[model samples]
Target: MALTIGIIGLPQSGKTTLFNSLTKAGAPIGGYATSTVQANLAVVQVPDTRVDALADIFQPQKKTYTTVEFVDVAGMGQASQAAKEKREGLSPEFLGHIRNADALAIVLRTFANDNVTHVYNTIDPNRDLDSLNAELAMTDLATVEKRIERTKKAAKSGDKKYVQEMEFLQRLQETLNELGLASDVEISAQDRVVTDELFLLTLKPRMYVLNTSEDMLGEANEVLAKIEKGEQVVPESLKGELKGIAQVALRARAEGAQVAAVSAKLEAELTELPEEEANEYLEALGLPQLGAERVIQVGYRLLNLITFLTAGEDEVRAWTVTRGAKAPEAAGKIHTDIEKGFIRAEVTHFNDFIECGSFAAATKKGVQRLEGRDYEIKDGDIAHFRFNKGK
Candidate 1:
């Protein structure tokens, strides 16, 4: 199954705009709260230069890129937060959409517009982030409390495992009550089995997306570059408009979260243009790529996923697997039967293959290696599995 990430933020935060840019779905964007009552889901191919380069080299009949599903969930307050304050927790319909998401992209608005309304009547990304975080934490706290009660009952049967589970749940409850994420509570490897089943929203890997004004895009990129390069100085002129961005960055650093800034309105407009025109427009704007694309790539990596390639005259495709996945497991992503009849994988690094210009030349240079089922797949590996039909 394609990994999914849910897009969430306050009303008028440009989440739908980002979704439109990422998926090119052109979903309606407005101030109406009911507009997003039903989640908007789209699967988008991950943009990879490596995939294009491989397809060029192989002259393949087909080229496939790994895909990720983005679900534009409705603004938070419509159901979840209202229910949480009543001590009832998230509604089933709302929970169902996001419960299975592999990660989350929290959209925080840093732009100021007199026409577009902010739910809180102000543009403060940090405040918006904290408000959303509280709601998610509350929803998770309710879930953890319910599980604690159940585990307490189960412990009465004298199962030591239940007792351990009860202790873990209580710890989770305490952390959530303290406004901490379920992820903040460190647990043993065995304990993860129990916690992973909870599907706690706060525990999911998350990225912060700052939706900035078109005029601020360049400055936003500059701020991000400075942060990335570990520069300590900021220009006096930009400090005012970038305060929200700085606040969000500090919060992200405190929690070890990823952050990206984008002009969602501009990106949505760019999506309406042809690819070549869009590239020229982006170049004119001094952007390497769309912010929506950066968010998708960052969220993909946040899930601890890596892409491996399969190249041949027939096809050149990118496959997604969790980091540290073994050869047979990666093959299983293609077909279970292939994994069931596993033999060995012939592998070459993408860079090596590009340098050598062909498989035969790579083998001549000893760059291609034969790997067993136990071999851990690495990113950029170009692999071909040889498996028997009758195993």
Candidate 2:
């Protein structure tokens, strides 16, 4: 499957800069707030050290890593009450791109650049989040209202199905009306069939990207570390410097979303340098890795995904599947024929393989196991499917 994450935010939020840093596509920046007619897209390989290690050991003909596609669309916001009332917050073109994305990477600017203007004339990430939420909720509200109208007309047939659907749509309509996310509303299995078609923006998993200034990068990293450590309370001393970041982080935690802090300007510049030089620069800044990398990593996790490996002299590859995927379903990720003709899977953990040095060694050490159709695939599992293709 090709995973896609939509990059969206208010105007001048450095969303394009962050996109360039993530993809190294060098997309042009500094345009008007809504100037992007078409989304800038790029498929970026998900970096994994395990794939490199397996490649080194097997010396495969080719190494293939799983990838995530990023779509950077125009900034979305018409925050006024009038726009919400008219249901005209998001343009149709923008909706077409974002609605299909598996997840969302919402860029929130905390960077203070005098030359580049902010859409709201001030930087308040929490307020910006509220505005974005309102826009999305309003959009979803329109969708629900239309569905309710149809369901109401359909219910006149005195069918129980339409009445049930009408009730669910009414609940969704009420939730979206109050600016609550559709995701927060309880959805049953039956409701999923209805919600799936609506593609409610508020229901997509999201990661909040705090675009910080270069000078505040260290402070931003420190704050993020604290948040990751479960220190929910922002310290008084560092609060002023990272107020927006801290606020966003807390909100992300409350909503079970992901949060990343990145100096997009610095990271984009680093992308222009040699790899070794870039590493040295990051070390000089006391940063362990690029912020753009963290954003990508978190976005992948937001989709509830896991990576399983396939190793051989012919190819050392990484494949993605949803967490808790059964062996047969994972085999299907390789090929539908494999799933149809499924028998069993020879699986070994990457760590165990490394400890044993090779598949033969792992099997000899009794670390390799044969998994059946009921087996759940785990991250970093080196798998070889045993199937009768002739079947």
TM-score of each: 0.93, 0.96
Name the TM-score of candidate 1: 0.93
- Would you give me the overall lDDT of model 2? 0.88
Q: What do the candidate models score in CA lDDT, each in turn?
A: 0.85, 0.88
lDDT tens readout by residue for model 1, 37-100: 4888999999988889988888999999988899987787545445656655455577788989
State the displacement of the C-alpha of residue 136, model 1, in Å, after optimal TM-score superposition: 0.4
> RMSD of each candidate?
2.3, 1.7
Q: Write the per-residue lDDT of candidate 2 for residues 48-153, one digit (tens) a residue.
A: 9999999999999999999989999877783456665786557666688889999989989898878888888988888999988988888888888878888899
Best by TM-score: 2
